[model samples]
Target chain A: MSELLSITATGLTKRFGDVTAVNDLSLNIHCGEIYGFLGLNGAGKTTTIRMLLGMIRPNTGSVSLFGIKVQPSQSSIWQRVGYMVETPHAYPDLTVRENLEITRRLRQMSATDAVEKIIGELGLMPYANRRARTLSLGNAQRLGLAKALIHHPDLLLLDEPANALDPAGIVEIRNLLRGLAENSGVTIFISSHILSEVARLATRIGIVHEGRLLKELNANELAEQEEQRLAVDVNDTVAALSALGKAGIAARLDGKNSLIITDKPTMQHPDKVATLLVEAGCPPTRLVVEQRDLESYFLGLVGMKEEKKQ
Target chain B: MIASVKAPDNIISKLVPALWVELKKVQRSKTLWMTALAFSLLIIISGLFMYILKDPEQARRLGILGAKAQIFGGSANWPSFFNLVLLMVSLGGLIIFGFIFVWIFGREFGDKTVYDILSLPTPRVTVVIAKIITAAYWSLALILLVFVLMLGLGAMLQLPEWSAATVWNGLGLLLGTGSLTVLICIPFGLVASFTRGYLPAVGCIFLVIILGQVISQLGNGQYFPWTIPMLYSGAAEALIGKVTAPLGLISYILVGLVGAISLVFTCGWWRYADQT
Candidate 1:
């Protein structure tokens, strides 16, 4: 069962002198899957990524990339891995081509189709000779990603890969990442706070909070949980909401006369609602079911009340 | 989509990429090269002018014997312009080399690009080692270029003073001074790793330079820790023929013990820098 695991981190812990940035975190990422690691600000996502790259020594536990226990001194496993960490900086002086060549030499890659391959694939042929420093932010990010992609690793770990990208750049990155995973079966472990993008790109997701795992689920499951709410428009929303409650259904006021039915409402449940509304001197004018979004499902899990703050 | 990386055989090979990567970044910054070139040219031009003005007869001697001739001032007028050039360049090289080393490491943090550096295929230790060697290579290149340039400058200026002894003294001084700069770099580099900005590293280098001068003033100061690189060999200083026992003792203190210990600490302590 575990043979197919591309990355398996167990009981990983890292600390500064006084603060525990990541504590006893365990994660399993199967092969050929896009796993999103989600968390808010300063939630140890960056620290965990560093450990897997063997950039830091975890105070305890272990991290294995491609099934080999990653060691601080031993760097063999990196050959099969590609990574982009937070706020990545590129060689400002090097033209995009020179940057690619340097990475080529470091990896000891041969002079064969290597240059043409990366250039052709990353669509970087246009900016090949332009000095990296002069490229705009979106261009620089594309170049940074291009540099990372040159090695063609089986596993790609990208931290906020799309953070600095503009909308079009973000779409390009998502498409490219998806293409890589689909064509080459590369397992990607990505961490981001952008839930909508994560939903679109990830096949599986592991949500992290305060240096601990909150949940792990497939995109389908998280989405399924959101399709439960119904939106209703009516007059006398207070009477209507009470009408819904007395009818053994729950509804919340969205505005003066608008209500959202949070619980699933069958045909019989609506009859109970209508009867209660007549007794409370209020009747519904219109009703419609609203498709749920993962955001609300997430808020539900974390117990965030939807107070129409938006 | 990794296709560019070649797995290095061991720690040393891995370190090369890291060093190469950093050097590439340095090269990307035009200001870095501007500073290095300006420093080199300033030393070469100044040393050349002084050699020609001080000893006309020696300057008049156009012999490319590449030797140091004993002249009016023990160190300054040592026959060939090479020795004069070495002394001046060494002053600039010591600070520039150390500053470059510190900036290479310090800038990564100060600029907040350290994560990009360490996240490459190689480990952080390899990255640190790479920065060390990258700075060493540039510094060494600067030293050798000055040595060769001085020899050429002597001919072009048509100086009468020329000898093989001058070459020996110049090479000797460069080596000693270069070694000292390398040693100075280790501590400053350490300070760079911990600090918020590049200023701390630059500050420590200035402090070392100032303190070294004060110690030299206390007594015969042209030896060991004082001159660093060539202090042990006393080549150019030997041409000048002025290395006191205390100076030699300081040289030993710097090259033999202090430098080695600092390297060990940096390796043990800074090998796995958190880099934030």
Candidate 2:
């Protein structure tokens, strides 16, 4: 494993009696890149992260982080890894300054860089003296983010890190995560329901559903999965259907006048369809182009698993 | 020219940071200040009545030591008023400590913060030990602080000289009383780590305390109260020159060993535990 591959695990499996939470999962995350681990509830995202952290052992598999084996006897890799699971609570009783102080002490972060510098970078000075319990969720998250960044660890594992945050808070955290990955060369593996936000921040994305990794694709790959669904407004529905059939293009009528065409939105495909429609009696006009949504893309990827179960 | 330095290892040190973070919860939540205020008031109120208005003059002097001894304990010098107040200090924060401890260890699941804890590089056992250690540290510190406060009160009242044996006995009770908290807490900490809520962990605490109170009552109170504060240590009885271990040393060892071993086993499942 290279330094770029901050964490690597293969054939990982965890069983609870008869139930298998994670099954032979294998993954390698690179340094200075944000990898989004997308999954629904109980989709083994948490289970996999736990194995990576060595909090739980896989029944049959091995894990190494930063080139070091993840065994109970070895924890040097942990010193260089930072993680925030679920909704992190800063010491509610401790003031912001005190919380940071404790985090600094825990991470043993005494060197040229200090807690004061990180504290300032996190913009926590205003509420530095107030108890953590009194801070807003956004502020508490900032404090959590501050704690994660205190030691400047090379690897960060976050699970639904932005859950329950307002839009602004989400954007702030998104910006912060991007900045960390871009400027400091930190490797982050994060999981969240917000796939588009994940797309905005993650360099690469892995979609896991039903304890299995469906696919791992980059932002560009997701964007490249473009499909065209057009709204065709026609006067006579029968005539429109007849014309669309003649063109060998598939389309369904929306209500009575509008027909939706499902096809690739390439210029050539749309142009060919337009030529075929104009040749017919009902010439199509007011065609609208729609991009594939995350939900649609995700459903196209993993929704079939649920359907199979049904 | 500088020497190349090697990075430090040993994950145990990470516990300090994570535990420090856990301890800070008390201060951030206002529960610490709230507990201290409530404890201070309880001391000033009930203690003033118990010590000052209750003919403490007789309790303080060697003149009435015989009568006071009958009432407090058999020839134990009526627990110098300060020590009496200090013993009662534990009672004041018992509820608060129970709540805080449950929150620290179990409430992560209750309030969903366990995810934050397990996701970190810190071990599950370290998290468990840190909460217990934090609670134990605070309990011991507050008890000692109250003892000092009572010492000041004793001076103001001009109480008679307290014996070295009484002081040592008081110290033993003070340490021993809180030590019982460790035995009491670890089992609950295990349950807290194993179970899913603050209520069940808290329910276990009450069960232990209630059982201890009932057992102490059934055993003629004073004789066994000090004896079983964590175990049947003759340390308190030894303070007054009484010899012979109250319970077999092996019994004491067994109680600690069984509790420690059970706690560790519960931690074994933790290797499979997720962020929560």
Give the winner by TM-score: 1
Where does candidate 1 stray beyond 4 Å?
Answer: A231-246, A250-260, A266-275, A282-289, A303-310, B1-32, B48-86, B110-113, B117-127, B156-158, B220-250
How does residue B225 of candidate 1 score in lDDT?
A: 54
Q: Rate the local accuracy (lDDT) of all candidates.
A: 0.70, 0.65
Worst 10 residues of 2 chain A by lDDT: A301-310
Tens digits of lDDT, candidate 2, A1-310: 4666887888888888888888778888888889999987888988788788777778899998888888865644566877876677865556788867765654545453456777788888899899877998888877877877777778888888887678988888889889888998889999887677788899999998877788999888878765546666767778878877866667786675777776554333666666666777677765556554676678678774211110
lDDT of model 1 at position A163: 76
Candidate 1 C-alpha error for residue B229, in Å = 4.7
What lDDT would candidate 1 get against the real structure?
0.70
The digit string of per-residue lDDT tens for model 2 on B1-276 reads 001112435556666666667766655566666666665665564345334334646556644543533343232223535344544544444455556566666656665655445534455566666777787776677666655665565555545556677667666666666665444455565667678777787787677568656765465333332224433333323333333334555545654664577567656655455433
Go through the candidates in order and give the clash count of each.
Answer: 39, 10
lDDT of 1 by residue, A1-310 (tens): 5549989999998889889888899998999999998877788898888888777788999998777888755555667777888766766667888877776656556455676677888778888899877887777777778767777888999989997788988998999999989999999999987677888999998877778878898988867765755566677787677766766776677776677776764433655555566777887776655566677656555556654422
Question: Where does candidate 1 chain B have its weakest 10-residue lDDT segment?
Answer: B65-74
